[model samples]
Target: MPPSESATRLPPGPDTAVTLGIDPETLETLTYLQREYGDMVGMTKPSGRLTYFINDPAEVRRILVRRHVRYQKGPGFERVKMLLGNGLIVSDGDAWRRSRTMIQPAFKVQNVHRLIGVMIGCSDRRAVAWAAAAERGDTVNITEETNEFALELILISIFGDDYENRFMKEGDNPFAFLSKDSTRDLSVVMKVRALRNLVLEIIEERRSRNEESLDFLSMYMRATDKNGEPFSDEELLDEVMTLVVAGFETSANTLNWVWYVISGHPDIEQSLIDEAGRWVPTVDAVTAENLTEMRYTQQVLEETLRLYPPVWLFTRRSIEEDELEQYDVPPGTDIYLSPYILHRSEHIWPNANDFDPDRFALVEGKPRKDRPYFPFSLGPRRCLGEYFSFLEMKVHLGLLLPRFRMQRVEDDDPGLELAINLRSKRDILLKPSVR
Candidate 1:
């Protein structure tokens, strides 16, 4: 079969070379392409690699779920690989499969249930700090506050006792830089290397003691493959680093946006508070069951993710020929799917730019499959920490929102910063007052 005849022709795109990297300009270019060229626009990179911007819902689901095996993690991950090594986020093929299998057991709902106390504890710390800030009438930087809360929660979940006794005492937290610094320069790489070595040291110490514990590290240490093999030290280090980076960033960014969005919509904020009070009336009442009962909070989080998905852009490369809707995706073609673009597309979602949690409201005997929302993504490769992150966010919001009311310090919108993670360009400050 000849190259042109065997596959359907590519969709229409601009003749100008498009440089699709992790930057704001790339997002603007993508938005323009989608607007001008319709849903499935095709382009050639300056290097002559074929690229497709898939905004159609059916096609997006087909690429991510049904035909996932025909693709691999594509470009733009070279920078991520520097930080995460070949962990689950950047790893593909048998390596990803093997690592995912070993790590899946550790994230089971039962296992995650054990971490609720830790979530409450992290939220309580935030409450105490915010209470003091409210007393002093100071504006709270919700961005940095969410970052620290998520960082502390994940660290405790991953390290347990060592989070305090070992990791903290090393002066400043080596992992804290991952949250603060978004740039993936040489300096960031060096810091990642240092953090990796620190994690490796912890692994070695844990192995030496050979005692059983309940943290992620302990479970991962005990997890064995179908062949009864454990992850090598380097492999374990990469996986741990992946967990920390993946676990912390998404929840923190979403919560930061939640506060900003909630402040603008007082009616929605009161609904969340009422829902939280009904479910979790007191700190002692916080539990996995109670948190799950706060259905309105979940909807609010879902709507937030729909608007500000942390991973705004995702790229993959087709390793083999595939058919998506009417278009034929030729082998070696690069794929671009932007949740941020698709979520806000006026065609797919009516009034898509509006912040409406009711879009996710549950109706009796109604199904939600038709919605084109996948903030944590879909398919087997979907994030394993999705459940954990949701629990953490819910606990933080459900417990904290009831006691404190936050007013946006500034009326102007905090514009988006399109990077590897979608975040507010400036720190969002809010005035917290006791309710």
Candidate 2:
């Protein structure tokens, strides 16, 4: 079949050339395309590659879950590759498969459960800081607080004792740049290279010790392929960097929004407080079982993610010809899917812009699985840290919300910064008072 015939079958989009890059404006561009061309829109990029912005639920699921093998991690990942190297998030084909398999065990529920004490400790550290701020009448920068909290948690989780004894002894955390600096320019690239060397030092020290440890670094070092071969030093560094970047940023961003959202809604805030008081009245009482019982907090986090998924935009390149619903995807086509756009689409979710946690509430007997919700994404490529992040967030809110009440320092919305990760354009500030 000729390309024209296939093109005709694809959904209609503007004939004029469109430039889509991974930036804030890409959201507006995609929204414009969806509004003008409907659910499945096709256009030609400046590179002359055919691109499709797919919103149809079944087609989205098909590409992400069913026919994932036919596609590879596509455009916009070059920037991520600079920082992550061949990590699981940016790598494709056999490389991704092997790394995912080797690292999967470290994220198992039991393994994550072992880190709950660390989660509580991290949250308590924040509590102490916030209490001092409360006494001093200082406004808490929730954005920075969450960033530091998550960074500390993931570092301790990954490096264990070395996080305190080894990594911190270097004076300032070298990995702090990942959160403080968002721009992916050449300077960020240089910093990433420098961080890799720091990680290599830690790996070398661990290798020389030759003792077993419970941290993720030790686990990854021990994890072997099906043939019983371990990851090369370079490969291990890539995976470590990927974990640090992936594990912390998403949870931090979500908690930052959660604090902002809860500050405004008193009824929701009170309900969450009540739940936390009942389930986790004290930090010492926090356990895996009670944390799971804080169901309302989970809904709040879910709704927050629906509004601001950290990885808001995703891209894939079709390696072979494939058929989508009512369209033929030719080979070498670039695919774009936006969880932020789809989660807020009015056609799929009524009153999609509203911050209603009840939309996720169980009805009749089951949760609303039919709704298009993929904050962490879907399929085998779905985030491995999903379980860990949830537990961490729950612990933070459960212990913290009960003890302290926060008021939004600024009444205006912080607005969105749709970069590689979806974040607030301005840092969210809140005034904290002891409850």
lDDT score, candidate 1 = 0.90
Worst 10 residues of 2 by lDDT: 1-10
Q: Please list the C-alpha lDDT of all candidates, in the order they appear.
A: 0.90, 0.90
Off by over 4 Å in 1: 1-8, 365-367
Candidate 1 lDDT, tens digit per residue, 138-179? Answer: 989999999999999999999999999887797888788877
lDDT of 2 by residue, 291-364 (tens): 88888998999999999999999999999889998788988999999999999999999999999999888788
In candidate 1 the C-alpha lDDT for residue 355 amounts to 94
For residue 105, give model 1's deviation from the true position in Å: 0.7
The number of residue pairs in model 2 that clash at the backbone is: 0
